[model samples]
Target: MPTPDATRFTVLDLLDLNLNEQNALNLRCIGGRKGLSREITVPDLNRPGLALSGFYESFAWQRLQIFGRGENAYLKMLAESSNVEIYDKLFSYPIPCCIFTHNLAPSKEFFDAAERGDCPILQTDLSSSEFSSRVLRVLLDIFAPQTTIHGVLVEVYGIGILLTGDSGVGKSETALELIERGHRLVADDVVDIRCVNGSVLMGQGANKVIGHHMEIRGLGIINITHLFGVGAIRDKKQIQLVCGLEEWDANKVYDRIGTEEMTTEILGVHIPKLEIPVKPGRNIPIIIETAAMNERLKKMGYHSAKEFNQNVLRWLESENARALYFNRDDFL
Candidate 1:
């Protein structure tokens, strides 16, 4: 599901985004202040090159119309014709905004048309290609499917392992130990998982304020950053493996051989899952670290369980062939 606030995204939010260097859009309002509240419903951009030539068929008016150098020149040519009717027709559609890259500015007549239609006109210092890539990235993340999961997300052996199970099942405790072992903690209690690019599950804290804090049974609440320093915390990580910490059940027939792989679905993506039973002296952190390494091995096409089973089958086949040869009438 798209984020609740994604539907309400406006041109104002794009201007107000807190982006860092390289990803910063450097966008500013150049005209049509009344249209700043216009909602951006799409994650794509339109060049408006063909639209400027009066070819309105299949015109993507819903997207952010980009006016690069070529489009700006065309608009200038249209302005010289003493015809403002084309600009009015362009603004008649409920376009989110018109963004001019390379810090390009439209003519006075263009701005007048935008003001009449209440369509915001934005400008950026970045080039057309750079601005298009940056804006599309930000919009994809905003429109990605997101859900809040009650679990602790941590990185073990450079692999993101999500600790999930019933409450008080030692999920947080296991993550705390993993953190003590020098692994990074992504999120403690509430993990906001977003499915990016339709396959990768990116996990981070739901709330930035309480992200690095963990709630222990006896210790109440503790700040992980202060306890372990900033090197032990991560802002976000891709969830590669899921380790379900459940109370050790004697009757449950757990897979001892590890031959049959198990997986669980989160946001339509199937992630490799391991149900690690929790009990005294189990050393859950070590098991998770090992599981992370094993997952890496599996990704490299080396499955330990399958390899061992193949070796055993080879030995059994050889022994059976020798016995049958020795039991033949001529050999006896």
Candidate 2:
């Protein structure tokens, strides 16, 4: 199962905690993660009102990181802190994470203290602005769940082929061919996969933007939905397979028989996987199609190698029986 996004929090966000009288801050203290208490202690700042310090205690900053939107009170409090560099970095960070940086690197003392009940700290070398930008991009990338590349996603037979490589790796070209052969296209370059259950992962694109676009290198962008109509596209499908394209390596050993099944785990879900080396003379699109079809057959209770081995064993037994029973046949 894909791990869901992390639950977020901050020092300022500590107020609305309304924690139980136990005064624990570990996972259990929050009533979400068990035994999470005894990790961090919230000290009494002993101040109130709109001064810089008070804002840190405010609900705004706390809520923003948790909910992905910051409030005013916390912002003002952060500005007032003496740890100017730390304050800037925290403000710049879009996601809520315990930070230990620059002068405030955690000591054995602090680590031991947090183990008992303190916030874990993160250390970074970048300046406030640079760190902030990096953190923001990470946060946005995680939370957005919408930054998608326009391409085609197809479930050929049962194998999910995610055609990706360098530009002009013929990813889209292969997909276009597969689609013409009546295979389903799930998404283009951008595939939105959500873990629906413990082992099932489903893929689809935004409905509003589904089946509508393709990005070709020289042609730039083309609207696939407009040209091909709705039947040419798909909203979503279960991700059961993965086929990655790579430049050919003669020395590399590829799967000669379907005996060894490889899998890739995403978000916690594992799907069967294959790496198809790309080369000039090889017909990749057809090869991918055949792979998908073969996988489908395996799922349908047929093991080609096992069946062949069984036949060979039967032939050997029959020959041995005839040799041993030669006298018995005449006696009977």
Candidate 3:
């Protein structure tokens, strides 16, 4: 699925991405300005070596084409041999763009063909391997299935816990307590979640400007980063657990024993879920903290509730065995 608020992801969107230094693409367009608006539909990439060699049997013309030094060298050979027909044949399909790695430049003839085909040609300074890896990673993140959720995302005890509930269910208040108690807040109110690699859900604030800002019931708005320093806020985190906060009910039965596991689905991926009932003197923040630690223990192969149940079962069996021995005919 596409992100709730985003439109088509074009080549211009990739260029406009504000990535950090380590993951920056450093791409610049050298030709075909009118085709920069072309949409990139796929997450995968193609090297275009086979297409350049006139073997277009299994050509992946829809993906972003990465032309390494070898492909450029072949193109140079083609230019020398006046084999210009292959360029037109290659651009015949609506390829997203042609990316030249290692600061490689295309010949005048190739640029003419790209202009004629209305295909954008991009250039990068990194080597073929490095650029390919970086661009692929970026593309995967962009094309990943995404959706926006109404909740607060926080990191407590090194686990991402999504606090969800009705509008007036004290979800934000509980998250505020969590933040004040030395935990880190990923986002407040609106969380943009993306399912990366089809398994892991990465969550971040919907808007960067107001991501760190939180709106309490009466406090209006407060900046978490400024109030708690930079250590109390993070840009993003994986959604490992979901805890739904609800008003405490007098008649509804709650799960006292944790033998059975519960889960909730988001973006078609399931994660551990807990429904927490809130009332006065409930100490929800501490409970959430403990829940985070318990989740970690579960990941480490320790099940507290299950172990306790097994111990109780063993004790009952021992008691029954003792009663049988004492009441046996031979013993009596």
Candidate 4:
């Protein structure tokens, strides 16, 4: 679900990305240096076995090409058979690049053809499966669906909460209070949200220049990390709950019991949501804290509202039975 702009990443950018040390693929330029500037516009990868076998009908030229052990063996066979036309047809398209996994090197003829076509060739020490899985994960993240929202994302008791409301509706103030109460702030104001793996919604600061900073109307801009230290701020967090704040509406009937669960959808992912009516006396931060804890409880299969309802029903049934028995005794 990536946008066109997000898919404009080049091979040079991929090589230069500061990926996690544990998940690093140890990639390096093996050949075809001129094609390093070539753009990779998709998160998918293709194994060119069919193309190497002279079948190029539905070849996926846009995706990054992977040459694993099988493909390398076939390339050698093609070379032995003196079949050079497949290579010519393969490199004719604007393919992003070719990656050799497990340090597998290509034939001299293949290298010569790639150089002629100006296609970048990358090498990695990881096995074919390992390299493919790692690359796919990184590409999926880069190409995930993303959006920017005006809200505050915070982690309270290990729960990710996204607070949203109209401008000047105390969203920042509530987050400040939570930070004071030993919670971590992910992002304030403009929150950049991304849907990862088609299920989880991750949130971070939209602007890195002003990350972990909040703007209060009267106080202007304030840095949360400087005032509260590193423990108060985080880079990103998964949004598990959405809390919408609004001015107290007396006419609207709010959910007094927790049975009626509400949700908000973002990028096709439905997240639990709550509408909190802000008032002068209500402690918004504390309420949010309780809501987070309650959400955790619900995840653990304990629903307070449902339990209360069951208890009320049991009490009503017992009373009705006692009344009927007493009336029968009186009639006898």
Candidate 5:
């Protein structure tokens, strides 16, 4: 099942007094102006506070006064003072603002000061590294969700297959074979994939009939559309399958039957998958085409292995019946 889009909680969203109290066991947001309090609080790993001019001048100076001249305590004092000063500056910037804090809890003094027009406080359950990763991913997904990549995509026997592997993995070779078999080629060499409607993955070729050409190591590049005619190309295809080519490992046990289904995940959607081991004399293109046909058969409710096994069992039962219930004298 597709997971819901990662819910992003801003400083303002989490700052609600009611929601804060509800999830208080997990998170605690305190202080900030009550009436004008919906301030933006995002978890930013970039030390926005450190960049502020004179951040060390105000809070750092106060902490030194409170603790006096203790040289060993300076590091602890500096960290705490910087966090406070950062929060102070973030609150004054804009409503929807965020700053990151680590390890140390906000002191009562800081929270009390924040209550008097200070910024919203956000606590994260993730470790420093983990929180940074999650925050960056959410930000990237929300702000920039699309990217273009160069690859090949094909549709065989009604199943859309995307072929991707190392530079010399024969992706284009296999696509060419499928096209020769009368199946349409969707995209070749450079396929553009986009996640539209959050669930469906649509793939198309680049400009200049990217779906109409194929490249071979010895032959260089050949145009399938011109040679094989217009029936050889497709405008676009839904990505129903993904085949990742990897160097075959002798020690690794690979799936040999279709009883279990394997899937490849793209943009959080799981598409049917198959691992075709590569080796000298192996007809990988034929294997992929057969796999697509098999998938189509499965969709039509026909299973060759299951049917053959059932027939074998029935034949054995007939032999047993002859041994158990038949009489030689009756036949005579």
Candidate 6:
């Protein structure tokens, strides 16, 4: 996993990001254009209602300030009263920026205070709650814990499977076969993974320059999209299962019954794992595909291994009962 950094992003970077329309915050600069370069270090947002009320004891001025309808109205009241003390106190801190929700216009005093403080003032058409939720979601994703792993990630049967092993373990080769079988390849060689919502593991390519490109020992670097079209490539995927390939060990006993489920933890999230032994003739790609399908079945509450064990027990019981009955009839 990549180490966390004290990354800082400017208000202009946030504005320039091309988020999907459904999750867009619709932010636009209304005033304090000179402060657009202010840094937004934290992902959390702050409501300045208390600050506007002159409660500066525990003000979170470092956060991106949010001014909803109530805060806007209070600012108007403060403007009418010619109360400049609260604004001065609030703007004294290095506030990153102020956002007005519901497309609310800022009062002249509020704009003047932002300009003087060099804090950017932004507006959004979304309601206060909607804007808050959208901005928070985006920020959480941006600030999520990230790491890079040497593996190949692919989507097989709608399940994201991460294949890992030592060098020349054929991780990319298996992924190529999976793609040939109509599955989608997420990343090759260097898989960039992030912890989303503290429970989900999201994987993508580490570098966009060589994204969807795989390096096979004999074939060199190949572009999956160009060879297999767009359907064979995916930008990102939620990693659900991890498959570890190892050189065949004759002395080691592999799980043949599949009765025991194994898991590997990444960033505090445990993901289902399968260790497949590699051999001269073993079909690694097919095994991975079956593993992915079985994982999906388990998610749907149908565990193949458990079901197989139950069926075996039921059959044994029936055979035992029949044998006992036949023996009793012979005795009679």
**Best candidate, TM-score:** 3
**Ten-residue region with minimum lDDT total, candidate 1:** 1-10
Candidate 4 lDDT, tens digit per residue, 1-332? 22334547888877876676767978998888899989988889999888888888999999999999999999999899989778878999889899999899999888888998999999999998888888898888878888889899999999999999999889999999999999999999888899998999999987667789999888999999999999999988999999999999999998899799999999899999999999999999999999999999999999999999999999999877877788777545
Q: How many clashing pairs does model 1 include? A: 0
Error of 5 at 199 (Å): 3.6
Q: Score residue 17 of candidate 1 by CA lDDT.
A: 85
> How high is each candidate's TM-score?
0.92, 0.50, 0.94, 0.87, 0.48, 0.88
Write model 3 residue lDDT over 89-169, tens digit each, in one string: 998999999999999998999999999999999999999899888888988898888898999999999999999999988
lDDT of 6 by residue, 70-183 (tens): 998988888889987788788889999999998999778878888998888899999999988989888888788877899999999999999999999889899999999999
lDDT of 4: 0.90
**Per-residue lDDT over 245-300 for candidate 5, one digit per residue giving the tens place of the 0 to 100 score:** 65688998888756667887777777888777777788888888888888788779
Q: What is the lDDT of candidate 3?
A: 0.91
Score candidate 5 by lDDT. Answer: 0.58
Clashing pairs in 3: none
Predictions in order: lDDT: 0.91, 0.52, 0.91, 0.90, 0.58, 0.88
Task: Give the residue spans of candidate 4 off by over 4 A.
Answer: 1-7, 73-86, 104-112, 327-332
The candidate, 5 or 6, that scores higher on lDDT is 6
**Clash totals, every prediction:** 0, 25, 0, 0, 7, 1
Model 2 misplacement above 4 A: 1-152, 158-160, 316-332
Better of 2 and 4 by TM-score: 4
User: RMSD, each candidate, Å?
Assistant: 2.5, 15.2, 2.3, 3.1, 15.6, 3.1
When 2 and 3 are scored with TM-score, the better candidate is 3
How much is 16 displaced in model 6, in angstroms? 3.4
